[model samples]
Target: MRSSPDPALSASSNAMLARARTTFDIEAAAVLGLKQRIGASFVQAVQKILEVRGRVVVMGMGKSGHVGRKIAATLASTGTPAMFVHPAEASHGDLGMIKPVDLVLAISNSGEVDELTVILPVVKRQGVPLIAITGRVDSTLAHHADIVLDSGVEKEACPLNLAPTASTTAQMAMGDALAVALLDARGFGTEDFARSHPGGALGRKLLTHVGDVMRSGDAVPRVVSGASFSELMREMSSKGLGATAVVDREGRAIGIFTDGDLRRQIETGADLRALTAADVMHVGPRTLRADALAAEAAELMEQHRITSVLVIDAAGVLIGALSINDLMRAKVI
Candidate 1:
C-alpha cells in the first residue's frame, strides 16, 4: 500500500550521502598518512613539552586556532600543563603569558600565517623552543621552528578544494597523537585522569569507592544468623537499606536478606513469623570489598540482578551496605 520515494528526492539523498562519505574517506586517509609522518620530530616535540619548566603555549590563526584550543585542553586534561595564546593577542600584549622556560606550539596548515609568523622573532629572543605543525615542511613557520611536525594531506574535502577540511582534520589528528605521546611519557594513569575530570561520570567511576558511598555504622542493617525473622525484619526496616547482613557470632557476614528475598519467600507461602535469619537469608550473598570501585559494585549488582549488596572487610566482617539508591546518589549508576 506504500508508494515509492520520488526519484528526484532519492537522487538528492544519495548525492548528499555520497558527499559525506567522500569527506570522511578523505579525512580518514589524511589521518592515516600522519602515522607515517611521526618520527624524530614528533618525539622531539613530546620531549620538549615534557621537559619544559613552564606550560606549553599554543598559537594559531583562524581554523588552526580552534584546533589549537582543543589541543591545549586535551594536553591539560591528560597531565601536561598547556594554554592556547592567540597569535594576534600575542603580538599585542598576550606574549607576557609565555615565560622563557615555556615551549611554544605553532599551528598553520600552510606554515605561512602572518599573525603567527610575526611573533617568531620575539619567541626566539625569549629563548623559547618552538614546535611547528604545518602542511609544508619548507614553509616559513617550519623553517623557524626548532621542531617541525608535518600535517600534510593530499587534498581538501571541499568541493572547491580551497577550504580547510582534510587539512584541519590532519592537524587535529596530529595534535591528538602528540597529546597521547606526552601522556604516555608522563606515566599518566587513571587516578591522575580522574583528578583532572572530577565532576563527570568518568570521575565517579574512577574515584568513588564502595566505602565512600556505602551505609556504615548504624546506617548498615545487621542481624545475627540465629536472630528470629521478626528481629531481622526490624533491622532491615529501621536501617532502610533494603537489605540486612546476617553475621556469625564473631561478626563475620555469612548471608544477606533483601526485600526481593522477602517477596520470593512470601510467594512460596513460607511462614514469616516462624522463620529465623538463618532460615530465610540467602547464604554467601554477593559481597563487595569496601575499597572496590563503585563501578565494580554496579557491575556486580547488575550481574546478580540484585538491588543491594553487603560490603565486607578483608576479615569478612560486615563493614557496610550499599543499595542502588546509593549508587544513584553518587552518580555512579
Candidate 2:
C-alpha cells in the first residue's frame, strides 16, 4: 500500500522549484543582456581572428577557464584553429606557446584576474593580438586588448550574488558567437565539419558511401536471365540477401527476384518447377550508383518498401549490392 504524503516534505519541494525557476530566469536574462552590446567590437574580434595566420590561444582562470576550454574546442571544430592555455600556467613557460603569428582570446568576468593580468604585458610584447571577453569594459584587461567583447551580466544567479553563474553563461555565449562568426567567414560547410569529426554520427552519414558499405564481387547474389528456378533460389539462399539479381550476359541487372514474389506465386498455385529467373523476376528494380551516399540507399529502400538495392557502375553493370542491414551495420542509418 502507498503511504500518505508528508506536508513538510511537500513544502520543501515547492521552495526548491521556486529557487530553480529564479536561477533560470536570472541566467537567461544575463545571456540576453549581451545582445545589446554586440556591435563594432564583436566584428573587430572576428575580423582579427580571420586575419590571423596561427591558432587562437584561449586563456582564463577559475570558472572562466572552464568556459574558455569549451570555447576553444568549439572554435577548433568549427574551422577556426584554437587551443586553451590556462593563465596560471602561462607565467611559467606556457607563454612561449603564444607566438607573434597567434592570437589570444582572454576570458575573465572581473577583468582583473591576477594570474591572467600578470601575463598580459608578455603577450603584448610578443605582438600577439589579444581579444578580451570581460564584464568590466573600463578595467585593465580591456585597456590592454586589441578588441573587447562586453559579456557583462547585471547580477549573479546565486542568492548570495557571489558565485560565477550568470557571468560564466554570458562568457560562453559570447565565445559561441565568435566561433559562429568565424565559421561563416571561412565558408565552413557540413563536409568540412565532418572531416574534422570522422568518428561522430554526422561524419559517418556524410563520409560513408554506397561503395564503402555495399557487398562486392561474389558476395552479391546474382543469377543469369535464363537461369532455372533452382539456380535463383540457391543464389538467394547461399548469399543470404533474401533476393537475387537477374543479370544479362554482360553483367547488367535486368530484373530482381525476392522471397515475396515466391510467396505470392505459391499463393496463386502457379507452377514453380518450369519457371526461369526472367519469368518470375520483377522488372525495373531500383538501382543506385556506387558513388552515391549510403544514406541515399537507405532512403530508396524506405520509399519503395524494399529491404535491398543493387549497386551499379557508369555503364549500369552490377558492381555491388546493399541491404538495410548493411546500412545498420555501418551505422549510416
Candidate 3:
C-alpha cells in the first residue's frame, strides 16, 4: 500500500502553477499594449522596406538577436527579402552585406547596447535607412534611427524584474506585425508561399495533383458492363485496387463493382456465376476529377466512407484510380 502524499508539496506545486499563470497574463497584456502603437511609424517601416531595392538587414544582440533572426525569416518567407546579421559581426566583416539599397532593422530593449551603438555611425555614413525597435524612444539608438518602433512593456514577467520577459515578447510582436503588414502590402499569395516552402507539407498540399499520385493507364482496373463475374474478379485481382470501374463503349464510367458490392451480393444469396458486372454493380458511383488536389481526394474518401475512388475527366471518362493507400504512400494523409 502507498502512503499519502505530503500536502506541503502539493501546495508548492499549486503556487508554481499560479506563478506561471501570472507570467502568462503579463506577457499577454504586453502584446495587447502594442495595438495602440501600430501607427505612422509602423506604416513608414513597411513603406521603407517595400521601397528598398535590396534586402532588410536585421541586427541585434543577446535575446533580442534571437527574436530578430525569427523576424528576418518571417519576412523572407512572406515575399520580403531579409537577412539577420549580428551587431558584433557587422562591426567586423559582415557590414559588407549591407548596401545603400538595403534597410537596417536594429532591435534592443534598452536601445543602448554597446556593440550596436559602435556600428550605428558606419551604417548612417553608408546612407542606408535605419529602423529601430527599442524600449526607450529617448535612447541613443532611437535618436539616430530614421524610424522608431516602441517596444516597451510595463514590467518584466520575471519575479525579480531583471530577466527579459515581457519586453522581448513586445519586440517579437512588433516584428510579426511588421512582417504581416509587409506581406499584405506585397499581395503575396498561397502559390508564392508554396514556392518558398517546396520541401514541406504545405508544398505537398498545394503542388500535388490527383493525376500525379493516382493509378492510371494499365494500373486502373476496368471492365465492360456486361462482363462476367470471373472477368471482373480477374480485373480486380490484376489491378489490386479492391474495385473495378464498369464502363460503356465510349470509356465513360457508368457504374462500379467493389469488394463491398461483392459482399452485399453474397449476403443476398445471389448466385455469383449467374450474375454479370451489371447485376452487382453500383450505378452512378462517386468519382473525383483528375486535376483535383490530393487533400481533396482524402476528404472525399473520408466524407463518403470510401476506401478508394475513380478519377475521371471532363466527359466523365474514367482515367485513373486512387485509394487511401495511395494517399498514405504520398504522405498526404
Residue-level lDDT tens digits of model 1 in 23-122? 9889999999999878998888888888998999989999999999999999999999999999999999999999999999999999998999889989
Backbone clash pairs for candidate 2 read none
| Higher-scoring candidate on TM-score, 2 or 3 | 2
In angstroms, the error of model 3 at 328 is 1.8
Q: Which scores better on lDDT, 2 or 3? A: 2
Residue lDDT tens for model 2, 236-311: 9999988989999999998999889989889989788899999999999999998899989998999999999999
The per-model lDDT (C-alpha) reads 0.92, 0.93, 0.92
- TM-scores for the candidates: 0.89, 0.96, 0.90
Error (Å) of candidate 3 at residue 222 is 1.3
Q: Any runs in candidate 3 off by more than 4 Å, and if so which? A: 1-11
RMSD (Cα, Å) of model 1: 3.8
Give lDDT for model 3. Answer: 0.92
Model 3, 112-175: lDDT tens per residue?
9999999999999999999999999999999889999999999999999999999999999999
